[model samples]
Every structure is written in structure tokens, then in C-alpha cells.
Target: MEEPGKIKLTIPCRLDHVHLAGHAIKGVLAETIKDSELVFLIELAVCEAVSNSMQHAHGCNADCNVEVSIFLCNSELVIEVTDTGAPFNADLLKNKQCHDPEDATCEKAAEGGRGIFLICRAMDEVKYKSFADRNILTMRKTIKPTDRDGEP
Candidate 1:
């Protein structure tokens, strides 16, 4: 069993596995929070991150494991996706902005590279690292109280 504020689930790095992960996460968020929009955003961010690993990191050649850890603290949701695969080019994402959707560059037209862009835009914060043969991507989104006067 998980603690009150944390949930951890692991799924195989297969195309179908993404659906299970998404469903589990969405359920948890729904049960824990009253706001549905926030829940959907978190779910989408996680799905994209895991999908990227299944498609690009594993190259669809070998079975892989994706470990998802979600924790809620002070109304903030933190999600991490970790996988064992070839190291990713973290520099490419950090150095370049998401292609202007209208840009006609070859890289922008490619399917594989756009996953990171979607992940970045979907979450409030996105970070990546390659450590000890694992690629870890962490995304964070905060849920502000409806009465709060400040912007999230």
C-alpha cells in the first residue's frame, strides 16, 4: 500500500502499457482532488513522458520497465518517469525551444522528437537526466486553491 500522499506504480514499456498507467494515475488524482482539469493535465504529461520512453528510448526492440512515482505535497503534484535505455540527448531539449509549430524544419516535422515538446508544454515544470544507465524525467504541476488570489 502507498502512503496517503504518494503513489507508485510500474508498467512495462510497451505501447499498451501507457493506457494502464494513464488510467491508474487519473483515478488516483480524481480520488484525491476535487479539480478535474488539474488531474487531466497531470495524466497527459505522464502519458507523453512514458510514451516517449517506450518509443524512442527503447527503440521498440527490447522489453523495458517504466517506473512511475507520483507524490502530492501541499497541493502540488510531482511525477517522475524513469527507464533503462540508451541515454537521451538532454542538451537538445535544453538548448532549443519547442519548434514554433509553424516552422518548416525537418526536425519539427519528425514524430519522435515532438514528444518532449508536448511534455514540456503540458506540465508546469519539466526536467530530465541520464544517470547510471537510466533516463529520468520529472514533471511538476501545482494545484492552487480556488480562493487563492495569486496566479499559479
Candidate 2:
């Protein structure tokens, strides 16, 4: 069984193992997140971050590891996705920002250039850090305390 407030998972940097992170994360969220809509949004945000790292950091290579750490606090959930790969520049997205700001153009967004935007849209907070040896993307979502059946 996973811990109550914290969950940790590491998987290969490949599209195939992405679901492993998702499945384990859902188990944790199921215990805390009482709203189905919010659960789905959180899952999507997590997946986007993982997919981005897998694609950008490792170039879909399955040899490296992508670590996902999830922390559930009183009324919020914070998740971090970390990868060991080439340093990334978060400013790239800022430079590619669309006039609308919230999302890039359909052409770019549809081409998988909007992972950051989609993550930002789905979660309450999104942050990125590229350290000397690792890249970490953190996302947080506010959880509404409802019944155990995931009803608001």
C-alpha cells in the first residue's frame, strides 16, 4: 500500500510506461479526490508532464527513468515529474506563446506543442525547473472535499 500523503513512482521514459504512472496515481487520487471531473483533470495534467519529459528529455527513449512524486496536502495535490536528460529551457514555451496566451494556435496545439498549455489549463499551478542534472515539472490541483464516491 502507498503512503497516505505521499506517493512515489518511477518508470521508463517511454509512451508505453506512461500508463503505469497513471494507474498508480489514480489509486492515490481515488483515496483523496472526491470529484470525478477533478480526478480526470489531474490525471491529464500528470500525463502531459510525463509525456513531455519522455519526448523532450529522452526523445522517447526507454532507457532513462522518469520519476513521479505526488504529495497530497489538506486541500491540494502537488505532483512532480522529474527526468535526467539534457537541460531544457522553459523559456522556449514563453517565446512560442500565442497572442491568446492561454493556448497556442490550433496548428501548434494539435501538433503536441501545447503540453504546457494543456497542463496549465488543467491544474491550478504549473511550474518548471531545469537543474544542472535534472528537469522537474511541478503541478498542483485544488481538491474539493466530497464523499468517497467521487461526487461533489
Candidate 3:
């Protein structure tokens, strides 16, 4: 549930576009938010998600686009990223396991493919959907007044 004065921002999916998204999130938090910790958390989460799209979703192709939307509603902040890249096997993520420290797989040792894991850990809710050639990821974080009061 968003409060009465909810904020919404939408940006196109270009590598250059993330700067706009990041700026929007920071601007809103600075202008209206009173809690520093919560503001930082939301901003970081947005960065990770957008970075995933900018870096991985296009596989280095500069022509592809990724759409981003952010909204602050009553007690929740919602962010969505959508891309038209080839459909990915979401199950690959669901079944992923941490590699053994002694015998890490070559793929696991690589710098890619960790975004989903980070998103899962950092956000309260994560969902993926594919429709009409687009991959949509939605993430939410619950904001409590106590979260601002320094209560764990």
C-alpha cells in the first residue's frame, strides 16, 4: 500500500538509461525520505537490478533495450526491469547451488550469473515473467516506520 503521495518513475532500457533511473531514485529519497538506511537499501537494490539488465540482458549488444519502472507506495517500494532478450531458463536460477569452496565449477567462478542470487537476497519479493518476447522482473521491498527508527 503506497501512501497518498506516492512517486513513480519510468525510464527506457538503454545502457545510458540507468543513470537516469539511479538519479531518480536518489532524487526522490533525498527530497522526501527521512530514513537514511531504508533509502540506501532501496537505491542499492535498484542499482543491482538495473546493472543486471544493462550488463547481462543484452549480452554486449548495444541495440537491445531494457525498461525500468520504480514506484513508492505506502509501505513498499517496487521496481521492475523488462528486456527483450532471448528468453532465459528461470529454472536455471531456481536450481542454482553454491559451489563447494574446494572445487568450484568453472562457470561458478566466472564473474557473471550472480545477479539473481543477489536480487533474491536483497529484496523482499522477486518475480519473473515472460510475455510477448519480453522478460519482466519485479522486485519489492517493504518499508516500515520502525525501519527508519533504527530498529532491527
Candidate 4:
């Protein structure tokens, strides 16, 4: 099937606004993914990633904004969350969250650090990059094939 589309969104950096990304992603991907569980996973992962950017990225400053972009690439769903805040060390997140609390450092604290772990767990693939201008978190998941019209 030919790659058909993408959706991009920007929201104010506030906890209250995190739900917008979840709703937007589910709306956009609904045509391609019919699994309620997978939909929940996408929404959860997107919300967590965006929440991390808003809460930790800009010090939870509500004035800032978080950007989310979802695209169909290589027969997979690719989601990217970008922010203007200081970049954290991605190498620090190479491993999943440990069961023991002591194993997590300040960077991977159990609180919101759980978001990073969930994002990595839900999506088939996850990536992050701390660029000079912005930090980007990329997550990908392959969806079940749908009709050519993009209807599941």
C-alpha cells in the first residue's frame, strides 16, 4: 500500500493540554488501527511522551508549547514529539525501567520516568535525539493492514 498521510499538532505546554495529543492521534489513526488495545497504547504512549516534554522539558512552564507529528512511513506509524527545552541524555534511557526503585537514577526517577518506559514498551520502536535546537522523541509501531481506502 502507498503511504497516504501524516498529522502534526502543537499544544501549549501544560498538563491539562496533554490529552489533546492523545485524542488527535487516535482520531487520525482510527482509520488504520481498529484494535482498541492498540489505540489505547498509542494514546498512552503519545500522552506520556508529550507530558514528559511539557512537565520536564521546559520545567513545566505552561507558556511554552509542545509539538507532535504523526506520519505513515515504511508501513509503520511514526510519532515524533519535539520540544525547545534542554536535552536529556538519551543514553541514560537505553534500558527499560528496573523493578527496583534504587536502580533508577535522578534522570529515570519512577515518577514521570515511568512515561519514558511506557513509551518504549508500547511502541514497536522508539528513538530520541538531543539536537542543538530541539530535543526529539520518535516512536514507531506497525499497524495491521487496512483496506486501500484506509478503512480498518
Candidate 3 accuracy as lDDT:
0.68
Q: Please provide TM-scores, in order, for all candidate models, with all chains considered together.
A: 0.79, 0.80, 0.69, 0.81
Looking at model 1, residue 130 earns an lDDT score of 91
lDDT tens digits, residue span 79-139, model 1: 8888888767777567436653675777657554666776776678888999888899988
Candidate closest to the true structure, highest TM-score: 4
Superior candidate under lDDT, 1 versus 3? 1
Model 4 deviation from native, Cα RMSD in Å? 5.1
What is the per-residue lDDT of model 3 for residues 1-152, given as tens digits with 9 covering 90 to 100?
Answer: 74465455544556567677777777775654667766776677677777676676676456666676767765677778787776666774464353223477776586666656666766788788889988888888887766543345
Ranking by TM-score: 4, 2, 1, 3
State the lDDT at 34 in candidate 4. 63
- Per-residue lDDT tens digits of candidate 4, residues 1-152? 52357677989998988999999998886766667788899899999999989977887898888999899754678999999997877875588754346665887654635677778778988899987889999998887565223455
Query: RMSD in angstroms, all models?
Result: 4.1, 3.8, 4.6, 5.1
| Residue pairs that clash (backbone atoms under 3 angstroms), model 3 | 1-74, 2-73, 2-74, 3-74, 13-66
Q: What is the lDDT of residue 138 in candidate 3?
A: 86
Candidates' lDDT values, in order?
A: 0.76, 0.79, 0.68, 0.82
Say which prediction, candidate 2 or candidate 4, comes out ahead on lDDT.
Answer: 4
